[model samples]
Target chain A: MYRLSGGAILWQHHPGLPAATFLAMPAEPAPAARPVAAARRRRLRADRARQLADLLRHQILAGGVPGGVLPLEDVIAADYRASRNTVRQALDLLRGERIVERQPGVGTVVVCEKYPHGLDRLQGLAETLREHGRVTNEVRTVGPVSAPGPVAHRLGLPEHADVLCVERLRRLDGLPLSLDLSYLPMDIGGELLGCDLENTDVFRLLEQLTGGPLGHAEITLEAVNADAHSAAVLQAPRGAAVLMLERLTRLPDGRPVDLEFIRFRGDRITMSGVLHRSL
Target chain B: MYRLSGGAILWQHHPGLPAATFLAMPAEPAPAARPVAAARRRRLRADRARQLADLLRHQILAGGVPGGVLPLEDVIAADYRASRNTVRQALDLLRGERIVERQPGVGTVVVCEKYPHGLDRLQGLAETLREHGRVTNEVRTVGPVSAPGPVAHRLGLPEHADVLCVERLRRLDGLPLSLDLSYLPMDIGGELLGCDLENTDVFRLLEQLTGGPLGHAEITLEAVNADAHSAAVLQAPRGAAVLMLERLTRLPDGRPVDLEFIRFRGDRITMSGVLHRSL
Candidate 1:
């Protein structure tokens, strides 16, 4: 009986024969052991593939494989003393995890890391940009006014009640990236009207003014075509794609305190989050 | 001093005055209590808005409000004995949750529920469609061949190893929805070549064949423009937007069992998920 172990076929009668000798033999095993032997061979091949995948995975992650491309199958097969098929299997594993992708004409290449948007906590665009570099705010308006219908409802205020509305353009490294419009209930945010909002983080200012940490928020993300106003503000062409994030932040007491409508240039932003089955 | 409560301004000295009567009076509270009284009033209004939002939420969920459009602001205010601003606030809350959306010239309308793609488990496209209605599969091909470089690597097989590839078009209510291409290791899937895949669920077939459940899957979702072949299979125009879901399912023994590349017509699908901070 010939047994397959880790991509190598071992002859029970000639156990020391190398893989080349086994391949040279007739490609047939005893009929009685065919089922069991075939199953074992499949498992062995799978194991070898997994081992190779792990080695390549480390190489890719460690930057050992610069340019994100693996060598030709024939080269890898010769180096590992394995068939081209085995090398292909290892490459497929990486593709499954999206560590690399294969382009028809260009061959397999590493995929750059995507931006991750942690959905666990409420994070604002200004904070996201500041993490990469310094962020500057261009305050367009900040004043107390009779809140609009939707704004009033969001802040738990009476329709048309007095509220503080702040409109600003956020820039990273002096380039405009997003347009933000925020509304705060005047009862708690009236003092914000007196602060230099352009220099202060709105979230921090809110925390200081409210004298407490902000709690959970409900956020909605959607894609929309850029309207004329948003296009001009984001410096994108009219009708260009944009990502809109609408957020309603609440106090620990479950009182909705602020509503924000923000538009990001889609080409410059990608939101990613890991979805879990259980919490 | 006068106090505002539930959208009604009440006079402490003239408690018997009707809400309409108080509205007709000069809009002024005692100067000594103005700041403190105003804060209290704001909180009270916020509470009212929250209460209204909760009520409307229940109504929306219960399908009490048909046609997805809520009653006009004036109507809700009069029915609830609240101001229009209070009603607006309630409406805005629903909007923030994406339960409703306001359309220009169309009034406030309920938004259609988005499809939630739970990243918690490995679910096949057929199962997802069956939940909505009957799903039918059209098998395009089922054969064995030398696995492509990427496919071989993913399956942990030798380069150009023998493998079984299945191509199918999935339909819902007789309308094409998505195109699915799956690659499986021939050692395990070779027998599948003889099965009628049009009537069988591939995942279930795999589980039965392997005598175990699929452990987990690493899935990636991205937007892509439909290519000629995919567009023709999905019955969508070339260059139309499509959602690509690539999944690599593994066996409980930590071996990758299958690789699926699925493309859904963008207009027919919207993937959504609630991201929590911790699991």
Candidate 2:
């Protein structure tokens, strides 16, 4: 984890080498998170380092630094009390997380988030948000339509079966977020179709209908453009950065049941996954 | 689909649909796609519906419009020689597969091809690009270091285990495209650490070492800012757009083996995925 300070290069050696480990330095007691002004009196160097990393990490997350601009060694060393080598080490740590990268001539830059999906996991979009904090979900449209194409193929729509399309706007802390449309088997979700979406989670709503999802969900990720309707609800420019997530769900009996399309604000979010290597 | 030719739109109605359901104009052969000017004439108007779709789809696939921006109604209508409503319908078809969305004030923008993950189907960074056309991988750094919390956690690495960190500069058609690093528990990947990296697919290499991957992966999505290194390697500004992908892999028997972080040029790629609803 990078300090929101200036990313001042936490110089602790990789722990547990037996002899070279920096000796813990007593954890510094987190220094009671002194205010910005206290540095002149106590622990000057440590305070300097902490503040530096904190400031830099905040800038990186806040979009203040723009994207891909690498802070120079001279700039960082001058801004903070640490040496150039210390700053270099911190930059390398960020590189380890794929948060930044070094280019032969371009120096270093911040890596933007990749808009992707965790298809193999059972986590839903909102669920993913709640983990970090409370993001917002705005329900815009909910209606029935004839399931078509792969969606039809996945839901087994009888070529003419009516499907419920739940359109909503997803946000992080009230910002313009993802806009998407979800389709449900009319015969199943038709009754719950009229339920209030504003105050409830769709998964919970689905549970009320099917007694609870069997638990396995298959997901796919893609890149697409924003259309007029989604554009209006997401409040993003018609063709801004938008990430699309599609998923298929099944009952315990292994029968596929629903289809959903989730669009995310490309500038604000990214995705990661775990892969299990075969023996 | 939205075409860049004077902001042209493409209309595609299922041939099997009833006459009234057609909701489109008669098919007219596309003018620009004529064999001689196939690439340049791609901007023409009077094209067959299928040809229009192909042209539009080609533009989307070839990264024609910046970030894949698609003009909502007017542009699409103009391209397909169809009504605004018909074009919207075609856009809807693409939305199902996460090909596009509508924004509140922005109209419609194309999603670049950067986000692609979250399904049983998984491939390495190298493999995905190869499918796009021609690409090359350049090894920049490949060495070992103590695992960090995230990578350590994902790879199930012990607190002190030495993990091999492999960093590379990926080029597509000779242009520097992305920067990536993969972490592997030394015990698991020690054998191949010294072999060819630029020309070898990690997955294939792993398979040759121990066995084939059992094919299981879990993904998470988040957003971050690009740093100095990222800016330099991606050849973007100090803080340009980027996409970071994190992944972990294990053996068939469930042994953690590989963890990777990939950073892509924000404006250079697009992403997409599919989803199923809850039963």
lDDT of 2 by residue, A1-279 (tens): 122132122222333444223211111223454444454323333322322343354346545565558668887665433456546666664564355678888887887443333443566666656655554555544544444333456677654455565556666556766755566776665665456565466776776778865556666444444444454556755444355555566666766656666667665566654444331
In order, candidate lDDTs are 0.58, 0.52
Residue A92 accuracy (lDDT) in model 2? 61
The superposed Cα distance between candidate 1 and the true structure at residue A112, in angstroms, equals: 10
Candidate 2 chain A: 10-residue stretch with minimal lDDT: A19-28
Once model 1 is optimally superposed onto the true structure by TM-score, how far is the C-alpha of residue A278 displaced, in angstroms? 6.1
**lDDT tens string, model 1, B183-213?**
7886677666556567667887887888877
Say which docking band candidate 1 falls in.
incorrect
| Model 1 local distance difference test score | 0.58
Model 2: TM-score, first chain: 0.57
DockQ of each: 0.06, 0.12
lDDT string, candidate 2, B172-274, tens digits = 7776666766767766556655566667778778877875554655544433344554556567554443555555666777776776666666556544433
Q: Candidate 1's residue-wise lDDT over A176-235, tens digit each?
A: 767776777866666765565665668777778878777767665544445444566678
